[model samples]
Target: MFEHIDFNNLLATYGYLAVFIGCLLEGETILILGGVAAHQQALHLPLVIFWASLGGMLGDQALFWIGRYFGARLLPRLHRQQAAIERVTGLIHRHPLTSIFSVRFLYGMRLVGPMVIGASRLSPLRFSLMNLLGALVWAALFASAGYWAGQFLESLLGDLKPYRLPIAVGVVIVVGGIALARHLRAKAKEQHKA
Candidate 1:
């Protein structure tokens, strides 16, 4: 499967939908990587941004509507993870609209925020408008950042095609290790609270 779908082909085929699902599922790193691929000419920048922003907007809109219709039941169904629920609740309590846009940076809340807002009785039209704006901003930031970063990396790795896999693997391993550590720490905190 991996060999069948190379990066360029994958982006060309599913880049738009990937952005949508990424936003719906709160997959930022994946989305950013898409932007990196776009920078590599595997995808078109405007189309990438358009699709990403659209996906994000639609995902939030769907979640918001679900929240509006489902109300309190939405929270219990959407986020079973206690810590995430608590964090989102705290954010919503402290800063309604700000939390809506800002939480895009947070993996857990990126998808869940719209639902929570919907449950909280936020107006749908207003939320949709803001959500679209947020999606545009978020997609642009990550895509541009990833594109530039990939460019810098490419420059640094000039004529080093053979080392690409090793370097990529090393970076993934290091980042994955850090993520695992954070997950463990968060789990420990949750256990302590329990």
Candidate 2:
């Protein structure tokens, strides 16, 4: 089943969609992969960044509205995230603008930060503006990092065409493993807190 599909062609055609969708949820890995693809000329760097930023901003905006309209009802259902919610809430209170702009850069806070702010008394316009700025900066930074890594790997390998597939697979496996480990650790911590 996998052999019939050309991975490179698929990425070239649908890379932006992948980046957009991936960034809509948890996105670092996807954006990095896209950046690597761009470095390999499988995708355009600027378009990748644009789609990623849009997706990131839209995702946060949706979560913000959800929190604004349904936070009270949503809170009890998010018992596992109670600690995170509280922390973000406090940050928003103390430093509303900074917190809004910096949350994307902070680990474990990406999803919850905007929600917490929306649930607060912060203005919608303010959140939107800051969210856009943050998303763009975050997208550029991560994507560039991935591109740089690809460049370094290419230089180290001396020639990448012969090993591109294997190298891509290896990178994916390593990143996936790391993400899974982090997720498990976070879950364990949440359970311990509970």
Candidate 3:
């Protein structure tokens, strides 16, 4: 199934679009993949960062507004996120700026953090500025890691042409594994509490 797709062509045609959409809804993997493509000269690094940041900021902002307008109505539907929301709410009350800036860095808090802040008294302007900064930093950090990984692999393997798919698969597997582990741990904790 993977052998037929032309990655170079795909990246050339839909790279930015993919980055934007990906970042709009869970973007770390896409950003890292874009960075790798940049290193391979399939996409531009700066463009990748721009699209990723824009997407990330837009996504968070949308969620923020949703929480702002309908938080009370939405809260009950997000039972799994209650704990994270409460944690972020406390942080927002105590250190609003820091909470806004650092929320993107937290593993499970990325989505809920903005919502909780929006449900709080933080202004849209404040959230926008902080979200932009956080998105940029997150994009740059992850993209650079992807680029560096490509470089390291190139140095080690001597040619990345043949190994790109394998490397991509490896990254996906590792990330998916981590996500799965976290999900299971959270589920187990929920069961224990129950």
Candidate 4:
């Protein structure tokens, strides 16, 4: 049933939208996939970066706005996050610009940091500017990582054409596993708290 689908064609047709939406939901892996597609000439690298950057910035921006408007009411529900929240708040107090600019690069903080900043009542314009800059850098780094990884793998394997489906499937599985793990951990924490 799966044999008919051409991964390259799929990527070429919907790669940009996939990258944008993926970055919006969970960034790094999707950007890397986009880069891999670009390396294959199924998609353009610059446009991948562009879509990634835009999606990343808009995602953070949305989180920031959410924080600004509803954070006070919303934060109390996330009791398990007190420590991380406090740490982000402290970072915002001490190094707001750095925190904002570097937030996306930080592991768990990619999503939370912007919210913390917004909740802190930091300037919206400032967040937007730094978020834009950070998204560009973050997108470039991850996308290039994907592209270069393909290069390295090609050097090692002698051919990538046959491995495209496996590579994509592997990426999806790994990303899904990580996400599931995080979700389970959060649920565990919630249950433990209860």
Sorted on lDDT, best first, the list reads 3, 4, 2, 1
Q: Supply the TM-score for candidate 4.
A: 0.88
Q: Candidate 1: where are CA atoms >4 Å away?
A: 1-10, 77-79, 159-179
Better of 1 and 2 by lDDT: 2
Cα lDDT of model 1 by residue, 116-183, tens digit: 78878866777777787888898888778767766777798764334434544654576578668877
Q: Highest lDDT: which candidate? A: 3
Query: Each model's TM-score?
Result: 0.78, 0.88, 0.93, 0.88
Better by lDDT, candidate 4 or 3: 3
Worst 10 residues of 1 by lDDT: 159-168
Sort the predicted structures by TM-score, highest score first.
Answer: 3, 4, 2, 1
TM-score of 3: 0.93
Q: Candidate 3: where is the Cα deviation over 4 Å?
A: 1-4, 190-194
Per-residue lDDT value at 53 in model 3:
93
Clashing pairs in 1: none
| Candidate 2 residue lDDT tens string, 45-141 | 9998999999999999998998899887886688767777888888898899999999888777888778788889589999999999999999999
| RMSD vs true structure, all candidates | 3.4, 2.3, 1.6, 2.9
Top candidate (TM-score): 3
Worst 10 residues of 4 by lDDT: 75-84
lDDT of 4 at 45: 90
**lDDT score, candidate 1, position 192:** 90
